[model samples]
Target: MEIDEKDERIDKIDQILNDEIDIDVNQEGEEAEFSSLQDKYQINSGEALNSSDIYRIAAKESTRMIVLVGPVASGKTTMETSLYQLFQNSPVNDFCFAGSYSLQGFEQRAFYTRIKSKGNEPTTQRTSLEDNQAFLHIRLWNRNNNVISNLILADISGEAFTNHIGQVDEAKISFPFIERADYVVGIIDGEKLCNKKTRNSIVSEMIEMIRTFWDAELITDGCVLQIVFSKFDLFSKVENHNLILEKIKQQIVARLSELFMDIEYYNVAAMPSTIDEFSVGYGLEDLLQGWVRKHVRKSSRKMEEPFDELTEYDRLYYKFLGELNE
Candidate 1:
């Protein structure tokens, strides 16, 4: 039998794999050893990523960074897990769930809401202050355009924001990601908004937090801000919900309009207490659509930077391939 060019290449590759790589295919438990090697290199996914992991992803392709800002127990984690859970049933908006690097992270937070936990009401696990800076990643495929968007949602603890209230210098140092963020979501607890005593204070504190970021230069006038009122089911229980919501919106606009040119509001009952009355992941479709719209608009005017100085891998992955695709 004559060896063709393709066969010659395959044989050479096999020779390199067996000889140069020194793979003992005939050795006992070779499969087990290969699995061990994979584990040794930490090749598995499903864990929340850190800053270094995010950098690696960004270097490969463009990613949208979304930072959720709020006080503790304000539904930030719930909102994140709810978005992930939404894809479990069907596509969100027009985006389909392609995959996730942090499936374990999402499931861990959503465990309490599952029937296996046997809880009377769905409750989200509060994000710990220690893991406040972790990023939960999801890759969504757009049905209409056949485009893939990599979204990294920062699960920042509410304590992180509250502790740095009025502390601009500290906030600047702590939240460097805010400068690169595509969206900064400020979560307002709807239950607190319904309370007359806490309503004014919550509104004032939220404004002050934004001001601190503005003074620190972490959030610029160009930054897109999403004001999210979570647990709307509880807030809507109040008789004058519309009036109160209007007042809150007016207050936010009056305080933040000068600092943020793009400010959008969303009322979501993520994991609502009254599941029958309100659907799970309520109002999140609009939020997802808004993110896609803003991202498209931003990408149009954004300039591509030179990757000549970057590593060969980064250049190959991002510069060459990314530009060619564009």
Candidate 2:
């Protein structure tokens, strides 16, 4: 009876989720420009997607963007690299690999952090803010609905986030991308979660970041915020996972619960534990699954109004301000 009840609940949730999200899966792969990159290495067409490229993509009928926001060394790039590797090497349970406009972009970023790299020592270089508008694009074919979804992921600099936390205008000046994001992936270093001092600072920074978003009017009632505790493997070695998690919920979530209409949390390692290489990417699959569900659901629903894009005037104004600073 218990098993039956559990199954029933799962079915109900699936039904509700499907109703809320309109995702149509691709029945068969199409022969198009995207097909050429199936070889992964013989990339004839690919380039780093800049702000204009992403803006053009988003301007299309159904394109969704997921922006990563966190401090440096918070595993934003690691998570991204891991996701691409997973999609490339192996297919997620139900989702099939479609094609990416930025295949070479994914390969370039994912190359350094490849799990099979020499020495097996985790080596992830700090993501340099080369281009503020640049992003890695991943397109997936959702098996559930057979819908093709374009996903835009960004690795914004920690310094950029730090600069704008308490200051709205500063955030506006630095983070024009935030205003156009559909989801904000807030990454917290798991090692910090184990330390009381760092934990306190993390929550404060998170609160301030949210406040900046609120002040800028970047957050809408429908916008989703997903907080990921990265490097969970590190935390497990020193502290009780449940205890630290509960403390974060009590301290961080409790304080900022009212700000977001929808929120979720996950603990991911993104790589194998230092102790052993047996279990790699502990909670990444769950994170990606949740992300897929949210993406598809939002894509299916028609918005009451379209979102505003960053205009030429805004760009010219920022450029002018930069010249004045120089």
Choose the strongest candidate by lDDT: 1
TM-score, candidate 2, is: 0.71
lDDT of 2 by residue, 1-326 (tens): 99998887567547645676332343233222233343445533565577777876677636667777788778887887778778766778777778777787667666666556664566565666656435888778878787877778876777677777788877776667776777887888887877877887986787678768877877654567888888888877764778767777776667666776567888888875563832566687887777667432222122232224436675454344332121
Model 1 bad stretches (over 4 Å): 1-42, 294-326
lDDT of 1 at 253: 90
Write one digit per residue (lDDT tens) for candidate 1, span 29-65.
Answer: 5444664675568864688888877877778765888
Lowest lDDT block of 10, candidate 2: 297-306
Report how far off residue 111 is in candidate 1 (Å): 0.7
Question: After superposition, which runs of candidate 2 have C-alpha atoms over 4 Å from their true positions?
Answer: 1-45, 115-120, 275-278, 294-326
Whole-model Cα lDDT of every candidate shown, in order: 0.81, 0.69
lDDT of 2: 0.69
Model 2 collision count: 7
Q: How far off is model 2, as Cα RMSD?
A: 19.4
